[model samples]
Target: MGIETYLVVTDLLCSREFPAEDGRSDLGIAGPGYHTAELATSRGTRVADASMREEVMERFHEEREALAGTLTEWWGEPSHMGLQTIRLRTATEEIPEPWARLSHLMGDVYVWEARQCGRWIVLGVADRDPTDEIQLLLTATETDPP
Candidate 1:
């Protein structure tokens, strides 16, 4: 498959004002004293063979780093950044509704979190098959101090 990219943004300010029918604008349910926003994307690559995995991986990293740079410019350095594993399960699996649907693609996930502009921003990327591309998910949430 050729390289494909997707992005989703969720902001309470924008959503509460201008809601999206597809629900991409919604921050979903949040407890008292908290609000959230998010941006997610999928990056797919097209290669003639699996040997090109390295090249595809490089491109994925580039895209992710570029996104990080943008976040840094907008929010300053992240308070926390690291790699973590996220597992995905299939629909047949009795897991959360959201994750169940994503079970077809289960693997390691990378994440970054920061507090900026009065919100907590979370950036994540799910590990994909070396023969394929990657997916990125970003979220920003507002919370009141106790």
Candidate 2:
């Protein structure tokens, strides 16, 4: 299995525990969502408010809750080391503009929270073998008029 890579790209982080859908403590939530807008945070910086539409905020909350559920199921403990690879796939070729905006807002929130407080992450497996090509070649038929 190939390990997926995910780098933390946020300034502040949340360390407190939050309720997942199941009302569990093992599952925690963090986001740069409502924190500083500045790209980088060092010794001294101001935290900015996260911006989003009402509907978008609602969706973000739902997504965070769902994520919490998955986290609770996978790991009893929530920490960054647990997350090395995460999968993100969609039928859509590219994320819609609105969704992209929401993603940015949510991502920032989570990251900020994580930086402020410790965070937990989940790993994922990626397909790295040439099985697809091999299967395609194997399926080719050499016999004629069988």
- TM-score of each candidate structure, all chains considered together: 0.43, 0.22
Residue 75, candidate 2: C-alpha displacement in angstroms: 0.7
Model 1, 1-146: lDDT tens digits are 11122223423332333222224434432333232332333344444455455565556556656666665665567544332121222323344322322223323222223433444555444445554445444444343111
How many clashing residue pairs appear in each of the predictions shown? 2, 23
Model 2 off-target regions past 4 Å? 1-52, 77-146
Q: Give the candidate number with the greatest lDDT.
A: 1
Q: What is the lDDT of residue 144 in candidate 2?
A: 14
Reference-based lDDT, each prediction: 0.39, 0.24
Model 2 residue 79 lDDT score: 34
Residue 69, candidate 2: Cα error in Å is 0.4
Task: Determine the C-alpha RMSD for candidate 2 after optimal superposition of all C-alphas.
Answer: 21.1
